[model samples]
Target: MTLSSENCSEFQYQVLQRSQTLDANCLLFLIILGKMLLNILTLKMRRKNIYQNFMECFCISLAFIDLLLLVNISVIFYSRDFVLLGMRFTKYHICLLTQIISCTYGFLHYPVFFITCIDYYLNFSKTIKLPCKWQKSFYFSTVILIWIFVLAYVLGDPAIYQSLKTQGTSPSQCSVYVSVQGYWFSFSMVIILFMAFVASWPDIYTLVQAIRITSYKNETILYFPFPSHSIYNINSKKALLPRFVICFLGTWSPFVLLQVIILLFKVQIPAYIELNIPWLFFVNSFLIATVYWCNCQKLTLQSIVLPRDPFVNWKCCFIPFTINNFEQIEKPISIIVC
Candidate 1:
């Protein structure tokens, strides 16, 4: 078993290369799982009439595209064949393909955000909407054009080109491009979540004391006890904040933990996979919440309408406390059990 030094070095190299490839596969698998979960949640939470809004259209399209891309990647890995369209997709080529997607996705982040914001404004303000006949075509064209523009932009960008340039080239190594954007975004999100959790910590008990589920004729309703002198207001983020913290943390705590782990380990994830639907939704929720918080006065005056959230339903939280004369009050109420 006494081997030559050259042979031992070669064996070690093979082992290291295998490890790297395995790591890459595992990372890709995790991304696929996350996308699957997001797709399911989106569909479950989506309204039955999806065409009611452009945001839903965009959401469905993006989820489908992400799923399609991941499926394509999976097929290649499973078949162990890198050929497609009579062309070969070697390690570097596959990595390049994914990086292109990541870059394009990253670039479109702000555009999509602003577009959603505009969508909300128009819907809430009851202003400028396309005729029903033209709505679908209009939104479709917009989403398509946005994708085309971002893809073209990413391809032309010199920074992306520079990032794709390699340090070392070897058949055993799969080199993928990454950006500081992923790290910075993840780190910032972790900080924001931590702060939000801390700020909501003190108000948790007071929020709990003001609500209860009551059964009447076998139908249960989540009744929030809002007395004339009490603190919970229907319009304020103060009352909404704790419920958001509960639902948000309940649904996305695992993803937040993943971000924390990635940050701690300094994982260099490609921006393409890193900037996903969940992250975008997280940003969307935060932006909407910030707007509401800043306009608490307007909210109290009934000027601002709360936008519909695809993931977290703001409609679930309500108040109904100090009901001495229940017969005198005639208010619209929901019957939700537990």
Candidate 2:
């Protein structure tokens, strides 16, 4: 009996060690991925066109915020047992901090996609035009106001603040907990879900428009000998819009739905889902980063290849004009008459 007990203890120790190692590896991967995304977005922002575009600026800003969130998570995960600033941070503190940051920035993700849809609508539609002078200022102001509103909302809510301060910390797990009975919590989830759906409607409309436009262009090009290179470039950029919309919906919609179900119905989410929902943000970030990289590649290729001038083939040949005096022509007629 003693020998069997010793073997079982050895097996348990080995399993525990492996689990710790796996957790460390996953954390390291997330950090590296976040760094890569930050670098790519920084490079994209450096480009003149990207800097000038409102949507691209928003995208880069979102990426930056996401990276900060990821870093905070990494710090919280790795330092769960460590004391900071002469104070011990329990699991509740870590979860509270994470929740606050995520809530503040997380609301922006869906809006970014909605803004992208608007950008596409403006680009493809002929009825509306935004002036160049006001575009940058307008978008910049809007982004700033959004951040301010989110901060105010979180800071001004007494119930949310109190709950964060008083939530119980589990000894075995550091995770975010939402009180199902909290009115603010339930209300926030409803708001988020509503916004998500509202944002998706425009995306769906824009996608259908994109598909119809692409097919029409393809058909037109098939019959025309001189296809406009500019049209091709515009279409390529439009392609990215749908891809991004799809990716954003895929990565975030399910998670949002799960939250809605939990908050509204007071259903207990499985341990596996509760543990994995946070990772969806990381996945969303990765997809956006991939899109940025693909865009950079397209830009590089465009820079290398000069676009052909549309009027080059239509140049007319110059013909010399000869003018003859009336008297000079009459002399030849008179000589023939004589």
Candidate 3:
């Protein structure tokens, strides 16, 4: 195919279109797989429930909504592409599905983010302690409140869904960025910012706690067997989560700041920069997975060993048992082996 100016323009457009389509499909699949894997970890962790079960459930629900949205996005992307390529797009059903997913995404995302915030906030405030029974109560109460707010906010504005359905004349035109939700979208954005703050709270708290613990103690042997300023280096390995957060924010901050710049300054973001947004999202997605991989050593251990465990109980599967004192046992002690 010899390229003319018109053909070149069209080919360029097609390439950009396909790139965006691939980005959407790939990102969604990654997120879906990540969510499923995380859920499996959560279920396994639910044995004695050392972690926040309520928060895990909320996270899972949010992932479900996201998965639904991703699938919708995938359908819309390809369906629209087919139409453009002179193929029949027989599915008005995809539009409805997309609408429903958008509404659900808009509805569910708020509560999940808020719940994540509240989960950390509760931790920050010391309103609940780890391994405490009252924590569940707090989680439920906060979740219920968030749900009530989401339901009321979503239902009260009938125009949001209507706008979403009508806003995109074609699949290429469809996006949350340019959606018909209009000014109200800003409100949800504020909520997302708040959630981000909440998510970072634990990291902040851990840092502060580290500082405090370092300040007051002298016998603290600072991470390794070697000696350094105890305050400067106590359990440095434990700084994983906070360090991960710092790195995450650092990596993704440019894209977020770009959004702020584009909105507040009302500047025309360059096409290259706009295209980079999806890649930035991809980077952020990887950061989250990396954080999980780095911080959750138990998860990594489980992944390596659990396949070989005779008992299929995911709970007991991760636990490695060791006996401290067994010198005077009359009968042979049977190990409670996994």
Best by TM-score: 1
Off by over 4 Å in 1: 1-34, 45-55, 74-88, 165-203, 214-222, 230-267, 294-306, 318-338
- Our tally of clashes for model 2 stands at 0
**Clash totals for all candidate models:** 4, 0, 1
- Candidate 1, 215-247: lDDT as tens digits: 433434344445567565655667666666655
Error of 1 at 25 (Å): 5.2
Please list all clashing residue pairs in model 3, or write none if there are none.
214-231
lDDT at position 234, candidate 1: 53
Please list the C-alpha lDDT of all candidates, in the order they appear: 0.62, 0.43, 0.42
Give TM per candidate. Answer: 0.69, 0.38, 0.36
State the lDDT of candidate 3 residue by residue for 48-113, as single tens digits: 423554544454444455455556556755565455466455333344444444454345433454
Tell me the lDDT of candidate 3. 0.42
Off by over 4 Å in 2: 1-53, 73-93, 109-134, 167-338
Q: What is the alpha-carbon lDDT for the whole of candidate 2?
A: 0.43
5-55 in candidate 2: lDDT tens per residue? 889999998788657644743654465465546556544434242224445
